[model samples]
Target chain A: MKLHFSTTHEDHRIALLAALAISIYIIESAFPSPLPGIKPGLANVITLFTFLCYGWKIALQVSLLRVIISSLLLGTFLSPTFLLSLSGSLLSLGILMLVHSLFYPHYLRQYQPSAIGYAILASVSHISGQFIVAWYFFIPHPELFKLLPILMTFAVILGIVSGIITQHLINKLCSTHNK
Target chain B: MFTIGNILFKTTDFLILLSVSSLIIWLYSIFWSTDTLYGQAETLQVQYYNQVAIDYPLDTDRIIKVEGSLGSSIIEIKQGKARFIHSSCRNQFCVFHGWLNIVGDSTACLPNRVSIRLKGTLNPYDAIAGSQ
Candidate 1:
């Protein structure tokens, strides 16, 4: 006898968003990177959009699925690259959750972080987490920290670009929903 | 919301932007600026097995071979950078480390028992360990 599987709307949404992130990740990986940690991180546009629009539970689900599925698809599952991606995703989601909690109250609405703010925080935490893990496990050398500034420079720039794209997507999403 | 290029950037966004920029600049000043550790590296010290280390000035360009347990490792210094040109070790990690130009930077060929370190007037280990 075959066991029946059931799914919900939330599951479907998570799957769809994760698919988008994974496709972007695969395409991004196709390009040769000049440095190890520097990338456009265009896939982050989806994550930031999900966190800014959807609640934390859904955002976390989508982001985790994205990292895990994408690594498996790329054959990097359980490798150092996979570990770095997992750590980066976890830290980014953690920071976004914290930011949303702190800034989402009605009184705090004026200080609410826009997509750009969330994207920058996510990008910084993601790279910081990956860098720390890399230094600890692989290199464990002081000289490795020297690359942090350069990696962070890329993170900030890419974060802003992803943020703008995310804001635009959210705007388009809102208009269609209202209609 | 602050509008630039039709994007809704808010106060907190600018605040985060400023903070991250300053942090990156601060790290750059500490690590990548011209006057930091790389500027002070004046000597390359090579050690072979249990032998006393020999200091080579960075001003001159030359090649040196140090006898190791496995075999001799070839080293070259040119234009203020030092690197292992060849090593008998299979991994070639020391050679792969590329260049050593920072005052505290060091690399060792573990299998061959040869090591190289960049040094300056001030001993960083002495400063860190408080006695050396």
Candidate 2:
């Protein structure tokens, strides 16, 4: 049985992906933490999977669509703050695409790169994009470089947690498929 | 093909090492010296505010001290008038919005809902934070 039904199998795959992406965005926005601006990006895991199961093109499409859709739904479409999120997602997707290409080839069985790389890269890119947005928003003074280390620390911890969760899920899926 | 398990194990180990190293470095940077903490505090303040956004220019003495509220409001400072300081807000982020110790400059606090116009040093944190 095909676990992920494509358009040919379950034409609703796109919608399902979209719905899942929406949930991810909500979780990202609503879930507050002591460390400001940190997110698990649980939805990106789906993007990674799409990139692996399908191709980079589809993965990119899913991410872009999800971001735009979520931004619109959340009423942040035209706001500058929303732009930060868009940039982060795009940069993160770019990195994930690179990772997916390297690890999940056509001939691969039920394995992929360690979730650590994804977690780290995704987090780094996300924070990087955020910093860029911050740079533009703040402008002048040119004194914000001081916060990079602290932000990076937050990214590292969140990335580890997200990566571990993604890893567990992937393992579970593989095991389930085997059974 | 690299198995996912192997990749995960290796990445986990690497992350563990990296985290440990960073923790040690941060600790070293923290207790061992005041430079790192002060440096970080400066950075945090700047980044949190989107970098230094001076609301006034130098050489202006019109000072409008914001004593209450945490919101940015415009105020005109003259050559010899200075008033406005302290705020009810918890963070006092507005108090840090800026200072006008000169002749015609102005500073506004978004958090404290206050603005000060004066002619003096734009570097408010200079005296307190020192040498950033």
Chain A TM-scores, candidates in order: 0.93, 0.75
**Candidate 2, position A147, lDDT:** 64
lDDT of 1 by residue, A1-179 (tens): 99988999878888888889889999999999988668888888888887777767877888888888988899999999999998998899898888778876788877887888889999999999899889998789877878989999999998988888988888877443110
lDDT of 2 by residue, B1-132 (tens): 234543355543475447644764674565444333232111111111344434433236444332334333334334433333455556654445544333333343456544443323233333322221
Q: What is the interface RMSD of each candidate, in Å?
A: 1.1, 5.8
lDDT (Cα atoms) of all candidates against the true structure:
0.85, 0.57
Off by over 4 Å in 1: A175-179, B34-36, B39-119, B122-132
Q: Which DockQ values do the candidates obtain, in the order shown?
A: 0.54, 0.09
Instruction: State every prediction's TM-score relative to the real structure.
Output: 0.69, 0.54
Estimate the overall C-alpha local distance difference test score of candidate 2: 0.57
Per-residue CA lDDT of model 1 for B16-96, tens digit only, reads 999999999999989876445445778999998789999999999999989899999999999988999999999999999
lDDT measured at residue A69 in model 1 versus the true structure, 0 to 100: 90
Write candidate 2's Cα lDDT for A23-121 as tens digits.
887777887876666656677777655554455676677778888888888888958767887788788878777655655566642344466556767
